[model samples]
Target chain A: MKLMDKLQILADSAKYDVSCSSSGSSRSNRPGGVGNASLPGICHSWADDGRCISLLKVLFTNVCIYDCKYCVNRSSNDVRRASFTPDELCELTIQFYRRNYIEGLFLSSAVIRSPDYTMELMIKALRKLRHEYRFNGYIHIKSIPGADMRLVHEAGSLADRMSINIELPSVSGLKLLAPQKDPASILEPMGYVRERIMESRELVLYKKPQPFVPAGQSTQLIVGATRDSDLKILTLTEHLYRRYQLKRVYYSAYVPVNDDRNLPSVNTSPPLLREHRIYQADWLLRFYGFKAGELLDEGHPNLDTHLDPKCDWALRHLDQFPVEINKAPLEMLLRVPGIGYRMAAKIIRARRVGPLGFEDLKRMRVVLKRARYFITCNGRYYGGIDLDSGLLYQLLSDKTDSKVMAGQISMFG
Target chain B: MVYVTDGSFEGILTAVFEAFRNREDPEEITLGGDFQLSMTAGIREISTDTEKSDRVWRGVESKISKESLENLYMAYLSEHPRVGLYIYRYIKLGLNIGRKVEGYLQHPDVHAIYDLSRRVGSEAHLFLGILRFKKLRNGVFYACYEPDNNITQLITDHFASRLSDQAWIIHDRKRDILALFNGEEVIFTSGFPGIDHEDCEGEYEELWKRYFSAIAIESRKNPRLQRSFMPRRYWRHLPEKQL
Candidate 1:
């Protein structure tokens, strides 16, 4: 097949894997290398789907051996399949990297023939890019679920990041949708990669320290493909973070492409709002220091689609409301609905100079529309309504949610 | 009364020194080219001196903090009309109370410098990814961009090291500035004619444009959201956006 046709087929198949981050690694260019990895990462463009196009996200090939019902590339599906030669993949990455169209390459592939064989081809492509072309830029590769440990380790040393997607939330869901894929096959590599990452960190002072997965591991969970509670998904995400020390856990709303009795109908829209809510809760877990228990309980088994998770949590714990902005600790400020991490830090920094008034908060650009309900600037409540009134709930629930789409991050603070 | 400096960063620093030496608070401080002849009352032209500017720069470094000095410099790069006056007032408060002035969000002058510095800093950072290079027929990679602030110098530092092995030129069309990197050193030129490239829209660009469109999930198409992250202003130079 032509290179353009191969790229189109492979990229279309790869579009569902929504892990496009290029951060947590800072590999500098060698004396004659062509590129470098940035610490915070850079987004070359945003796709029409509103996702950041950081790396040249494409699959090495789209032919699979397993029939995962929710996946577009499941072997049973009647879709076009194409594979790139090692030279073809390397040339595409370097040329795009030279033009600053991408920070690096995100190379994933289906289980072609076998897991180990697919991984071998991927490593060959990666080696050519790194050794022959001297490409020091970021390369994030996916470990085919059941790939051998030694092969994964070999690939880890060459690539900046490695990930294994946990597509289903529950074991039963995995069995119903993808019976051939075992849960052990998914978690085993995650455990091994975590160990290798720990080893690399311990050997930071080695005279010739070889880094392994310098950007660390991340995974994607397919939301709404099966009957999984937000609480269940979030608990698993928190477990992944605490156990594996994963850099990020992306949630891709299931876009039904294949017809299956167990899968949601293809006519149904992807649950994009639920995915956005999960991401909001994900941020709360990672940065806001909130626990799964704090955000949800048996009574509220799902995130409220009307209000964000942070706002929902604040409304439930009204005893913590009206905390004095001048006296509240950093943790308390973070719990406020409209204040993000940067804004919370800014408030703490600005308040240290003198008592901050509402005017100062406005100047500091804190979104008082929601934060006002929870915080008191100078022993005065500007949120207007009484704290105990249920009216705050009606007022705080987002109405102009027309802009609230999945992967559309406003980042207002 | 106003002070006119020689329209350089060091010249602005020297004006700060003169404010301290003469013990007179000027109404405004103007860079040389920005000065108007109509306002001639009590206007003093402050000459640039490395010795005096260095003293002021070092004082800001030792007394306030290195970051504040960096912030002041980035704020100066905004080239705002009254940016010199804002920097003067910001330094006055910063020297009085040291680095704590960074957190003085209520102060108008401090907020001005903080906001401008962050704008310039973030734009320079944004240009790092927004820049697009097309391979010219002559074999040199060429890209063009138009930024609001004076950030060509800031972004070129990043490309110089990242693409050091290849020859490239980044043209800032709005300011008519060029960052020419010839496999070794990057030279900044103001106006030295132009090289021609019709942007042949080569095969690689076609592949990139195809990959760009294919990677987007069709079910979740939201053009408004795409514009928010990659704004309309930058779409002019983006290769895939052209499609």
Candidate 2:
């Protein structure tokens, strides 16, 4: 087949994997190298789904041997298959980099003939791109489950970041949808990569450090794939972060691409709002010092779709409200509905000059409408109404309703 | 009195220096080319004096933090109306209150300077991501951009550091300036007339367009969100946006 035809098929097949970030690694250009990786990632373009397209995300091939019921490129499905030679892949990366089309390359693949064989082809392409072409740009590649441990290590050394997708949240879900992939097959490679990263850190203390996934590893969880609750997903995500030292855990709302008896109906919309709630909860866990159990417990297994996770938490714990903004610590400031990390830091810095008032907060770009209810500046409260839980919830919901209506009009018009 | 400068960063600094030396708070400060005849005020044309500008810059560097110094430079690059007077007022405040003036977000002059500087900084950062290049027949990678701020000098260090092995030119068509890097060092020149070089018709460009179109999911098409991140103004230079 022609190259353009093959590219269309492969790229179409690869778009479902939504982990397109090329960040967190600062690999400098060598004396004769052609590129360097920026510390904060650059988004070269945004796809129609509002996701950043930083790297050239493509699959090495779209031919699979496993019959994963949820995947678009499952073995039983009848889709056009195409594969790129290692040379062709490397040449494409260099040419695109030269033309400033991408930050680097994000190479993934289906289980072509076998896990080991597919991984081997991916490593070959990466080796050529890194060593032969003298390209030092950011490269992120997927590690095939059940691949050899040695091959996984070699690939880790060459790429800036590596990821192993835990497609399902639980073991039973994996068995029902993708019986060929066991929990051990995925966790084993993750464990190996973690160990190598630790070893590389130790080496850096005394000797010249060898790079072993300097950007760290990340994984993806398919939400709405099974009947897994948000509690279950958060628990597993917490475990992965603690166990694997992962950089990021991406949540992809399940887009129904295949007609499977075990999956959601083909007409069902992806649980986008639920996915968004999960991401907000994830941010709180990572940055705001909230534990998974603290955010959700056995009683509350799902996030409130109408309100954000932070606001929901704040509404439930009103005793923490009316905190004096002039004297509140950083942690207390972060718990406010409209106060973000950046704004909290600014407040800390600004308070050094004198006591801050509501007017100062507005000038500092704080969302006074939402923050007014929770904070008091200099022993004075500017929130107009009484503090009743139901009334506050009603007020906030009314604001959200108007905002969503405005968004719909702007989007459609 | 109103002061008129030559529309350069140094010229603005020199005007500030003269304002402090004469101990006169000017009613307005504008570019010499853009100076309008105000029937109510006297106008003073300040020559571009490198010595006076350098002394004022040195005073600012010693009195304030390096971050504030860069913010002043970025605000000057914004070329916003009355930005010269705003910077002058900010510097005067910084000198009086020391570096703590930067965090005084409630002060109007300090706030205006920060706001203008933030716009220029954001624009330069956006161009870092959206600037696209095309390979010419002579193996020189070329790109054309029309940024809102005078950020050509600010963005060249990034490209020079990354693409050190290749020769490239970034033409700021809006400002009639070119930042050319020839595998070793970068030089800025405004003398070269714009060239219409024929781009190499490589097969990878075709593959790139195909990949870009194929990667977007049809079910969740939100062109508005895409435009919010990658604005419509940058689409002219993007290869994937064409055709």
| lDDT tens digits by residue: candidate 2, B22-65 | 99998888865676778999989999999999998998989977
Off by over 4 Å in 2: A398-413, B191-202
Native-to-model Cα distance after best TM-score fit, residue A224 in candidate 1, in Å: 0.6
Off by over 4 Å in 1: A406-413, B35-42, B193-195, B199-201
**Model 2, C-alpha of A409: deviation from truth (Å):** 24
* CAPRI band for model 2: medium
For model 1 chain B, give the 10-residue run with minimal summed lDDT. B192-201
Instruction: Tell me the deviation in Å of residue B230 in model 1.
Output: 1.6
Worst 10 residues of 2 chain A by lDDT: A404-413
Clashing pairs in 2: none
lDDT of 1 at A202: 82
Q: What share of the true interface contacts does each candidate keep?
A: 0.79, 0.66
- Candidate 2 per-residue lDDT, tens place, A1-413, comes to 88788878988998888787778899999998888998777777777666677788889998999989999999899999999988878888888887777889999999988889999999999998899999999999999999999999999999999999998999999999999997999999999999999999899999999999999999999999899999999999999989999988888889998998899998998777788788878878878888889778899999888887888888888888888988999999998987888788888888887799998888877777788998999999888877764678865543442222111111100
